[model samples]
Target: MTTVAARKALWKIPEAMELLSISRTVIYEQIRAGRLRTVKCGRTRLVPDGAIAEYVALLEREAGR
Candidate 1:
C-alpha cells in the first residue's frame, strides 16, 4: 500500500540554496570543488539527504577539540 508523509528530502540546487541560505554561485562552487557530494538523475543534480549532517560533522572535525 502507499502512504502519505511529510518527510524532508534531498533538494535541488535552488532549494538547497534556500535551506543553507547561500547564493547559487557559492553552492555551485562547492559542488564543483567536491566539498559537497551530489547525485544526478537525468540532467538534474541533487544533494543527498545526509549531506548537511555529514558536512556539519566535517566542520566539527576541522574546528578541532
Candidate 2:
C-alpha cells in the first residue's frame, strides 16, 4: 500500500500488526495497558492512525525526546 493510503486508513488489528510487525499479544497488551489507544466494535479492535503515530512518538519521547 502507498504511504498516502496508509496514512489514511483506520487500521483493524491484523492490519496494524502487519504494518508494525508486532504480534497480536503485544498489541493487545499495549492496548490493555494504555500504552496504545484503541477502539473496539463488538469483538474487533481498531487502532487509529493518529494513535499509532502518537504511540510511536511516545516511544521516541521515552527514549529521550
Candidate 3:
C-alpha cells in the first residue's frame, strides 16, 4: 500500500490568506490585533493549523452570541 504525505503543521502568510480568503492587509491586521495566532521561525512568520481552526471557531462563537 502507498502512503500519503502528511499535511503541513505550519502555513506561510500567503497560504493562510488564501485559506481564509483574506487580503494581505487584513491578515496582518488580525495578527496585530491578536486575533490570529502566529509563530516566528527565524525571520519568517508561520500560522499553526490549529490557530486557523480556532479563529474560525471564534467567529462562530461571536456569531452565535
| Candidate 3: stretches off by over 4 Å | 1-5
Better model by TM-score, 1 or 2? 2
Residue-level lDDT tens digits of model 2 in 8-58: 547898888887779999988989899999887789779988888888888
Instruction: Report every candidate's CA lDDT.
Output: 0.80, 0.85, 0.96
User: Top model by lDDT, which number?
Assistant: 3
Q: Write the per-residue lDDT of candidate 1 for residues 1-65, one digit (tens) a residue.
A: 99898646777888888877789998889888887788998999988868866766776898996
Ranking by lDDT: 3, 2, 1
As for candidate 3, its clashing pairs are: none
Each candidate: RMSD: 4.1, 3.3, 1.7
TM-score for model 2? 0.77
Report the lDDT tens digits of candidate 3 across residue range 5-47: 9978999999999999999999999999999999999999999
lDDT of 3 at 43: 100
- Clashing residue pairs in candidate 2 are none
